[model samples]
Target: MDAGGEEAKQERHLVLAHKLFLLSHPDLDDLAKVALRSDALDAVKSDGMAPLFESLAAAGVLEPDDALLAEMRARIDEEVRKLDEKIADAEENLGESEVREAHLAKSLYFMRVGEKEKALEQLKVTEGKTVAVGQKMDLVFYTLQIGLFYMDFDLISKSIDKAKNLFEEGGDWERKNRLKVYEGLYFMATRNFKKAASLFLDSISTFTTYELFPYDTFVFYTVITSIITLDRVSLKQKVVDAPEILAVIGKVPHLSEFLNSLYNCQYKSFFVAFSGMTEQIKLDRYLQPHFRYYMREVRTVVYSQFLESYKSVTMEAMAAAFGVTVDFIDQELSRFIAAGKLHCKIDKVAGVLETNRPDARNAFYQATIKQGDFLLNRIQKLSRVIDL
Candidate 1:
């Protein structure tokens, strides 16, 4: 081949090889690397991590640092440590809730790598403790952080219940409102419209004091703070928008349900200027909180009503879902008889009570919708336990 043609061919081959490298690795390929570097400086700005700054400089995202960088990192670390102490103190007052979950959730990326047992341990510790207002809130926030960071569903649900409980009990309005953001994250994690909308409204109402508050209720403050740091970069490429990130927030399987809960909390954040219409008048101010409370009740009742079905589904699965005594479920079965909601019989042949209802010949749906409603009412007052 001619020299010129050979050179051109070599360039094309190199480009093709690079493309192939990206395609071969499904996760964290070249494109992701580029995107990650682009966002690195933002992390430094947003989170002010000495490690992140040092890492970014190493990655060529920013210029090498000097003593000033060390000083900055030190200051940031001190501030971060103080925040951590505040969280710890708040939880200690309630029974060291933050510590209960400290090991449970380290960070998002770590959790995605998979650590369900640690996260679950945090849940047990928190459950064993008692919490008052400040400490209770601290514990709730710790739970929120671990739940969102690690995407732990049980933690998310329990924390949501705790936050709403404190809010209803007249906990610090601002903090409770902040927890609404965490609550929104849970809904967002789940993609449940009703909960997300309510959480968003709660976040909006509490914005005036969000800055003064340092807690996990506002899960994405880190991301927001990160992006703002990237603002000074002399680069503008419509690579992705905020909404796009938020959209992707809901689909990450491990984080989906948790994200739905968060979405339910922040999808309608009014504190950011809703519509800018002078006379439009906000609807959520009165309607949203009350409605959220109503939904919470309904869900609890529905869960209770499904107790029989749940036991039949899988003992292990039900235990994971409800976060309460399986024995309690068994104990509650007798209650169903009084309500005319449960019936048991011996099937002489297969020798099983058949709660799953798989028997074709002697099978029946036994419980009427009315009986379901009766049982549902028993657990209907769950508003104080879960937000939505």
Candidate 2:
């Protein structure tokens, strides 16, 4: 063989060996360390394995270096440029389908580098093209991902609707499960906690049946949203106590502690657990939208419990129990009272909040009105029947 052929063979062998090594070492960090030590990455560099390098960078197995990243990006850009030219040539000779595949591959590369806008532009080209069910699913997946990352609920909803039909028709169980997750995320974004929690729970079951990516993320959302939307008993029965969920919860200590506090009604403990992770919760893409609402719901539960336990509690004592200032407690109490959530009277001067149970007279009046409405409806129906 010529020297060029011999060099190509060596590069191919090196790439194969690298793949085998990665397969043997499941841990990306461990593989990265070994690959670096053995000069395996260097051997494969000649083959222009941009995707491999990109994966390493994404996995944090390769430390961040600005110059190195820029160089890699430049190389990938050059490769994409070449591919664009090939795609143009193939459009006439190869076929439209082949050209669409090229566009998708390029779009994927852009997506990996976080250039979602460019990826989206590429996806737009392939959107209405005739493609296989699997390719159609890929299109839908990327569309939803772009919509979600950008916080465009309309786009996300549209993508889900489009994919739902395809997945249902194709009977793609795995992708359908993924669609559930995206739907859950959409509901969460919209602040529909009940629907979001239910969808997450259903998705968790599907995930258990067929191992899915980002399993731990789904578990976190499921636990947090369930706490907000479900009572203690329902949460325990459906989520916290589930064996599959428990296994996943073991991986997230913060979530585990939060769940424990919520289940035990340890208000102070729950606050501490939640406050410690406040920044992380805010930064999470999926959790940020619901965090404030969840916190309010938790406080409502805690305050309601307090009201039930005591006929009247001083603002100072309430503040102390909740680890907040008296002024904060007063303000929250006023807001709750205004919203009719807390049936209580607040004495600003005395700094006491007096709980007011529903008056028996008011209950009787409400029941009487409800019964009168029912009787009126029955009489009208009977009159109509007699006329008939």
Candidate No. with top lDDT: 2
In model 2, which runs have C-alpha deviations exceeding 4 angstroms?
1-81, 88-100, 110-118, 208-213, 289-291, 308-331, 347-353, 357-388
Model 1, 1-388: lDDT tens per residue?
1324333433221222233233333444566656544454444444444554564467655667777477766765565466457557666674455554442333222222223344345445554554566656675665565554434678779778867777776676667666666666566455454555545544542443232222222323322222222221210111122343344333222233322322233212211222221111112111232344333332333333344443334433443444545555445444544454454332324423325423444343445566788778767767546766
Cα-based TM-score, every candidate: 0.30, 0.66
Candidate 1 Cα errors over 4 Å, as ranges: 1-29, 35-131, 208-388
Candidate number with greatest TM-score:
2
Candidate models: Cα lDDT each: 0.43, 0.70
Query: Which lDDT tens digits does candidate 2 get at residues 103-181?
Result: 7777776655456577788787776564678778878777776675456788888888888788766846777777787
Q: Give me the displacement of residue 215 in model 1, in angstroms.
A: 15
lDDT of 1: 0.43
Please report how far candidate 2 places residue 273 from its true position, in Å.
1.8
